[model samples]
Target: MADKVMVDNQAIKKRRSFREWKEDTARRLDIWSRKKPARRKFWLNKTLYLMMIPYLALFFLFTVLPVLMSFFLSFTYFNLLEAPKFIGWSNYLTLLLDDPIFIIAVQNTLIIAIITGPLGYLISFILAWLINELPDKLRAFVTLIFYAPSISGGAITIWSLIFSSDIYGYANAFLIKWGFIREPILWLQTEKYILPIVIIVQLWMSLGVNFLTLIAGLKGVDRSQYEAAAVDGVKNRWQELWYITLPNMRPQLLFSAVLQISSSLGVGAVTTTLAGFPSINYAGHTIVNHLQDYGGQRFEMGYASAIATILFVSAIVLNKLIRKIIGKVGS
Candidate 1:
């Protein structure tokens, strides 16, 4: 009976201790919440905070939350029907070492991005520069012509018709008329021609936002700066372009680079539409297509999320690199 009473007393003391710790923690947290600088600032600018809520909510819902969820999902094994099970790097290992089609997709994606990305930027800038030289009305007309291919949703269909395997196809007819080859070439079907044709179509589509940005940037350049450059013995058009124009257009150039990198890396819709999804031995297959295959067709959301995370990281790295290069344009 004495031992039992002692045990009860100890139990009461232990419970009281726990209760005291809980109260202390709550008090500290309350004090910290009141003293927090961010909380104070938020309340100070209540109207601005209120105004930002909608944008913040949308951004979190669409961009930040999806990315975070995707990153988390990358390490898991998830088929849509089942719960995600943590797999611990197996997906990445398989992607890197075991998957031949993924290897092909990566190679194809890199090839397309390397060739089309810089080339598209150069061509867009050049076209914009030339158009900038024209009278305002003519410049607008020419811009429309170049930009039309990009905005036109059915442009790929037109390209398909032109590159059709039939002898009646425009490209085949032209080639045969010129005696370049006796047979009609299967532009999309043949692996040899697939990448080149896709690149061509991609370049055509590439002139959308970046091209417009270049035009705007060029227009925004002060005419007096060119006059000043001329006075400073900037003897040639090349010098003027290299030293004056490009430096002034850094913001637009940066914007265009980011746009081009993302578009080039994420080139699934066009390739799939033009060449078909798998694309004949995966010749025209890209990382984006691989992601689509896993996510959309196989319902392998985990692997798809891994691919997305990779793409996101690559874009960030490439953007930083391009910014560094662009930073040194004139200097």
Candidate 2:
């Protein structure tokens, strides 16, 4: 009975100590978050102000101003030929209630974003991880092979031949010979096939700068850390990745995630190149396509601005969510 009472008292004391430690940590965190930069530090870094001036000016003109203007114009009705007349929520309301194509575009964009974003990010990271330690010449050759498709503006010509609708086309000829189907599939022309083909092409071309930078990050990880981890009994590849590699690669991972989300959300080039802008039955149409339709072809500047604003906001939200998720890596 005495031993049981002593054990209960010890448990109570331990709980009290834990609570005190937690409270102390909370206070420290509050203090850290609330702290302001010292004036001395700012003055010490005064040279950075001059260095940033050119970039800040360009960014304001090209990035900040355009985003602000787009947001402002979203509430107005303006064609290229006329002055912008304030239409309040009419454009947004129309987007939600009236425009079936807009709905389709949103759905298609989401589908592409949902599919391509994670897949591209994951595949790029995996490839980077695998290639990081290869022979220098071989790694460079492989990187060039993976990256060339993205940089080559005329890459569609190659895909065009491959996915050509005629029986003489590579895919059709192969499929026919294999007895998959008697008829040649209209891969790019048909609504059903257009999106899938675009997804494939996009995936094929997805590894651009993101892959290169991630490989660079992996090369930066200290070799000693891996040796230390091995000593700590982390022999499995998955365990090494989870315990060491991921934590070390958080910045690169987050950056790649941002690029993937941005590219996926803004995926129109593959669709447009393959299926044309309007696409058959609007099946492969995306938000980017819609924006280009209004902003480029129709000259509906206000409506297009609204579309741009929506895409921008979506990208921002997705990036924030990605940051949150990636922040927990290695923790």
Candidate 3:
């Protein structure tokens, strides 16, 4: 009786273990089977996938590869002439701790950003609104005036007038004549004035095109909505404008706002053209200018790549902040 009981206990334990192992094996097989179909389907679309190969290759080549290379380069010291020796964040550390020019550049960039970002958009919005109210015939001419500066602003002649570094340069001559200051202000060379000058120029250059875009947006607004508001005893032009025009032009407003911010951030070419990098006391060095200093002047390809990475990141952060503000206002 004891032996029979022992044999029965052993058989019961064996059966339970077998069942457990079988169930585990079955579950894994089932999972494998399910995954296999997905894999097969993906492979079956080989031709379609092959069609995407070129775009994917280009994406990796241009975008992903550059980003990865920059990230790697940021950890190294490579001047494009020799091997890249890994410095392990020494470059970034030095930038944070000991780089006086970098600190000044950051300060100048922030100042210009604060000045031009909102002011440019606000002025452009006002201009656009005024233009939108005009008759079609006059509107074209006004738009042409506003946009011409932007189109021509990139020219060397325009830059020369603004930043000639000469006593009789256009801005200096005009300011001196007005007795704004006794001496001819070195607009580009002076540390105290370079950033402000750049901001003013940026504002002027951005006014027309952005304003025109806003005007088009305003014109697209539903006239019936305005009429209905007026019929409801809306008080004045200001109220109608506040309620109808701005809300309706949200998309264009957002676009112009972004453009203004981004352009201000990228105000390097003009700076470099007008005031050389390390602008007096390093007051006019923006990230873009910094990148150019490395990429072009020093030929430090790795350092330049790192600077480009930094600029890219800064741009994204700036856009996010601007968008967030716009969202709050729109809401």
Candidate 4:
């Protein structure tokens, strides 16, 4: 009977050991099952991350680093020949209180932006809409015509001849024949006419990438939606546009608005080219011109950086405001 008890105890111990092994196995399998999806997802996205590295690197190197450096430099007083000296808010204070030319630049920049930005955007959309109604071939031709002036680099020189101060200039001769004025007007030289001429040139050049984007957006809109609207008793084209077209093209509209704002506010190159760098009494001088004056001419790197930071902040704020306004368009 003692021998039988010993055998029975051994069997009991064996059973307990088996049960423990089974439970441990199950726990390990449960843990692996939970972790498998995350492992698979990491491997799946690994290729995408690798592909993105180059673009991210270039963006940081060129765009992000420069902006950061410029922001840091804004707080210092640095000339090109010397190291930066820390001066807190002095540049900004001087700009706001003492610099009358900076104020003029701000005013001119705003006037140009307010007029050309909205007007040019509206005109581009209208032209695109009208062209979209034509036959495909004709639409293509018209689009080329409207977009030509923008791409034709240095074509603005022709306007110089047209508005020349010479008595024999086209504008002067025409006006003289019509008895509008006694003599040739200094379109670029005189302060009174300078702003108007620059505005005209800017408007002429404004139908650019935004116009093309609008045309593409108009083309991409689904025809079936329009047909369904007609079935639903949508009365006219105007009603359809308000409800369907505008909502469908919201992305393109937002993109165009951003491009327009940037282009409009950064209107230095054209202004400098048309009206001289300083212009007459800085009549056409913009914020960009003032930036060039300090950064390029005077070598006051810190002041230039401060000006750049201000413009950058202004652009960001304006973009946000525009985005908010545009967000209400389709709703």
Candidate 3 TM-score to native:
0.73
Per-residue alpha-carbon lDDT of candidate 3 for residues 1-331, written as tens digits (9 for 90 to 100)? 9999999999999999999899988677666656688766665675799999999999999999988988899888888889898988777777678777767777778788788878888888888788877899999899888777766646535865856667768777787788886777667778777777787777777675577788879889999998999999878988887777877887887888777767777778767766775567667788788777877888876667766766678888888887777766633
Give the Å shift of residue 122 in candidate 1: 0.6
Worst 10 residues of 3 by lDDT: 151-160
lDDT of 3 at 106: 73
List the candidates' TM-scores in order: 0.84, 0.85, 0.73, 0.85
Candidate 2, poorest ten consecutive residues by summed lDDT? 35-44
Ranked by TM-score, top first: 2, 4, 1, 3
The lDDT leader among the candidates is: 1
Q: Write the per-residue lDDT of candidate 1 for residues 1-331, one digit (tens) a residue.
A: 9999999999999999999999998677666657888876655676898899999999999999988988989999999888999998988898888999988998999999999999998999899998999999988999999999977788888888888889988999999999999999988899998999899999989889999999999999999999999999999999999999999999999999999999999888888888988899899999999999999999999999988888889999999999899999998
Of candidates 4 and 1, the better by lDDT: 1
Off by over 4 Å in 1: 1-51
Runs with alpha carbons beyond 4 Å of true place in candidate 3: 1-68, 83-87, 153-156, 162-167, 172-183
Ranking 1 against 3 by lDDT, winner: 1
Error of 4 at 195 (Å): 1.1
Per model, how many backbone clashes are there? 0, 0, 0, 0
By descending lDDT, how would the candidates be arranged? Answer: 1, 4, 2, 3
